[model samples]
Each structure stands twice: as structure tokens, then as C-alpha cells.
Target: MLDQLSYKDKNTFLQNVHTAAILTYLAALLLLPLILAHPLYLLGVFLIGILAVVVSDAAQECLPFLVMGIWVAVFVMILNPLLVQNGTTVLFYGPELPVIGRLRITLEAICYGATMGVRLMAIILAFALYNAIVHPDKVTGLFSRFAWKSSLVVSLATRMIPSTARDLSNAREVQQMRGVNFSSGGFRERLKKYSWLLEVLLLSSLEGSLATAEAMQARGFGSRRRTCYNRELVRPRDYLCFLSGLSALIIGVYARFAGYANFSYYPQLDTLAAASDLIWLGVIILCLLLPLILSWGWKHWPYLRSKI
Candidate 1:
């Protein structure tokens, strides 16, 4: 259970799925949030993202990101009403300030902000799910065929996030052992204590990077004589996933072009999608979730594999 708290991929079917296949599905999953502005549609998309995280066993690992995204979404919700004053229905009107002018909040701005918030949450959860299932090594290797150094840098940066958190935890423990009390201080004093931790974290990160560079150099990394490693091969299952993902992607793109996925919130809010429009959204979601459905069946009904 403790292992679930970290972003380590388990030997689950979703985790073992071909990287390109999963990425194709991921692209389709992200497409809805990017083009759609209907609050209900975006909310549905975000809910699917949450479901994916739960199904992929990423709810725990992605908890921090979920919280952060919510905060950011709330910030958008609050900031938009203050910044934008273009709406037919005015909710609040405050006295004018010098440079900022009058403060006005409207239903349109509020609805738009909420829609944007939902969009952001959906996108963030998509990434959180990807990080949970996809191995950094696979991502690096996949892109390395094109840009080795750039891929390596990106992979390193992604991996460093979890390791850096662990390092900070270790540093906190060491400080506690040395009679340094971090939680016993007031706000300002606690900030000072945290500043100390940051200093230690920075130094350790720099030293670790230097050591990695030295080790790589010693191993003749990037040399012409470097040997090939075992490569990830695509199976029939991967191809199926890719096809389903492409199907979903095509549907989503068509929906956007048909304006079935867009909503208007400025001046006045547009009515939610009609029942006919929702059919496309439903199909897109079904296609996006095909991998999870397959994995569930594969895991729970072992005899099905024999038929396959």
C-alpha cells in the first residue's frame, strides 16, 4: 500500500501496455478538454480523468497534483470575475479603484472561469495518469531515436521530481535528529527553517547532477561504440489500442469542427449540448476508456485470455 503513494508503475496491464498505444489514447483523452467549453462536458471529461486515475491505481500518487490543480482552478474562478466585466447578468459591483476601475462580477465571467477550471483539471489529470502508467525510461527511449540529448534531459527532469521530494524528506529527518525543530516555530521562523531545507536540497541536487555527469562520462555514454539495448516491441494488443485511440481522436476532431463540443459563456451562456451532440461525446469517451475496460476484463476473467 505504501508503494502506491509513489509514482512507481506496477506490473498492471495498463502499465505494461505499449507506450505508443497508451500515448495515442492519451492524445485523444486530452483533445476533448482543449476544444470544449461547455461546463457540463468539461466536467464529464474531468470526471473521466479521475476515473482513469482510480482505475490505473494512480489516485494516491496523483493526489498532490489533484490538490494543486484544484487550487489553480479556484484561483482562475476568482480572478476571472475580477478581471473580465463583460456579461449581461451582473452579480456584484464594487466601488471604483484608481487604476483598476470598478470591480464587477458577472454570471458569464464566472461560468467561463469555471469552464476553464474544469478544462485545466482534466488536462492535469491526463498528465498525472500518464506519469503514473508510463515509465520514464520508455519515454526517453521512444524519443531518443530522434533527439537523444533532449529526451534524456526531459526524462531526467521528470524523474528528479519524485527523487527531489524524497531527498527533502531525508533532509527533514536528519535535521530532526540533530535537534532541529521545524514545526515548533511561528510563521516567520518556520519560513526560515524551510529556507534551510531548501538550501540543503539545492546543494544536494547540484552535487547529484555533477556525479551523474561524471558517471556517464566514465561509462563512455554517447560514444559511437555504445551498444543497443533491449527495445520495446509492439504487439497485436498495442495495435488495437492505437486503432481505438485514433478512432476516438477522429471523432473528437470532427465534433470540434461541427461545433458540437464548444459552448459560449461571454455576454450570455449558451445552452448545454443537445442530446444528439452528446452521442458523439459518449462515443469519444467510450473509445478513450477502451484500454481500461480491456485491462479490467483481462485481469478479472483470466479464461478470456485463453480464447484470445
Candidate 2:
């Protein structure tokens, strides 16, 4: 059992799948409220994604993982604020464009922007967590079970983007040291900088790809039958975990839409007086963090009791 649960095996992969599946469902639930009404609910969901990313990448030693996490956070926090423009009350006057009026920053708009940001964060975190935890080769093997060529392509693509991004960053550093101004520029200048960056990155990637191709050819990459180094066994615990996560997600979503998990902001946002509503809120919070609770209890119950 210890060997089966080792980092060399499928335990981490299963955990990632469990997380991805749960987050995907959570994102779906958040999306409905965003579409129907109450954009704040959507924002709440996105906040959860940010939390997941922080926790998941807290110990990632790889440069690519760190870079991706940073990028994800920036995209959600900064870019998301620009897109959403809805609110009941206008808080402040934003800049006016040629066509758009004096943009007023309303609570609704901020909430909407927040929702968009969080949604993006959640999806990106899910993918990043999967990449961090699951072996690319194991992913390919799982894919090969269904379609070998397609699986191989997907696994390679997933691994390649981050590899290429790192190479681009390194090349940019070299160019910067050689006195190329990547930062000192207007919008057009920035575009020019990126063009140069792309050129260098493409050249580097072409060389890297040629090397990879040679390595693949030497190792019989596309041969009739390819053997994998690690074999992941799908266990009962894996199924149980997946099922529970899925069930909780589905129920939570249904409850959300059915008005059971609904929160309001018109009359009041954070006023919880009634016992029934409090009970319902408790259920929602529990479901939202069910995965976290299960993982923690399983990993630390004895230690927690000892401390107590």
C-alpha cells in the first residue's frame, strides 16, 4: 500500500484528478449564478480558485510552475478588474473613452469583474495543479488507453507550452543583459519588444524541437508499440473520491439554483438573522470545502487529536 501510494505511483495523479473534477463542477455552479443574477456569488467562486492555486503551488520548486502561478494570479487580479462594469451603486468615476461615457465603478461591475477573474483563476489552477501533480508520461498512458496518437499529442502540447515559456523568459533575460530595452516603451514599443521576443523564442524552440525529434527517432517514439516507464492503477479509493466530489458538486449546484444556496445584496449582503438561512449557508460552505476537509482529516486527524 505504501509503495502504491508513493510519489512514484498514481496517488498524486488521482488527487489531481479529484481536484480538477471538483473545481470544474464548482466553476460550473459559479457560472450559472453569474449568468442568472448575483454576480457576487461568481466572485466568491473565483476567490476559491485563487486559494486553491496558492495552496497547490505553495511547494512547487520548478520555475515553470512558479511562473505559471504568478501569471495566473496577475491575470485574475489585474485584467479581470477591467472587464466587469456592473453595480447597483456607483462608487467612483472611472476614465471615459471616446465612445463609452464617464465610466462609473459600481459595486455590481466590480463584483462582475471579480467573478470573471476568479473563473479564469479556477480553470487555470485546475490545469496547473494537474500539470504539477500528474506525470506527463502517465497522462499519455491514460490517453493511450483511449487513443494513442491523440493522447501523445495532448500530453506533449501540455508539457511543451511551459517549456517554451521558460525558454522565452531565459532568452529575454539574455537580451536584456545585452542592452535591449524590453520595458522602456509605449504600447507600440511594447509590441515591438514582444515581436523581438517572439523571434528569439521561435528560433530557440525550433532548435529545441529538432533536438527532441532526433531523440524521439533514436528511441523509437512512434513505433508500433511504445512502452511506458510507470503504470498507474485505478483503485477503489480513486473511484470513491471521484464519486464523492462529483456528488457534492452536483448537489451544491442544484441547491444554489434552487434558491437554497442563494445570497442577496439588494436589501442586504451579509445579514444572516434567520435560523433556516444560517443552516443553508452552513451546508453550502461545508460542501464548498468538502475536499479540503476530507484531505485534512485523513492526513492529520491523529496529530490533531494529540495536540488537543
Q: How many residue pairs collide in each prediction?
A: 0, 5
- What is the overall TM-score of model 1 with all chains considered together? 0.78
- Measured by TM-score, the strongest candidate is 1
What are the per-residue Cα lDDT tens digits for candidate 1 across 1-308? 33443458566667777888888877766877886666766787788778777777777788877898999999999999888889999988999977768988899999888888889988988887876888868877887887888987997887787789889999999998998899897999999998999999999999999999999899888986445587877776687778888997787778778888777787788887688578988887787677777777767888754432
RMSD of each: 4.4, 8.8
Local error of candidate 1 at residue 86 (angstroms): 1.3
Task: Name the regions of candidate 1 deviating beyond 4 angstroms.
Answer: 1-6, 92-103, 156-220, 305-308
TM-score of 2: 0.53
RMSD of 1: 4.4
Q: What are the clashing pairs of model 2? A: 46-118, 86-108, 86-109, 87-108, 87-109
Scored by lDDT, the top model is 1
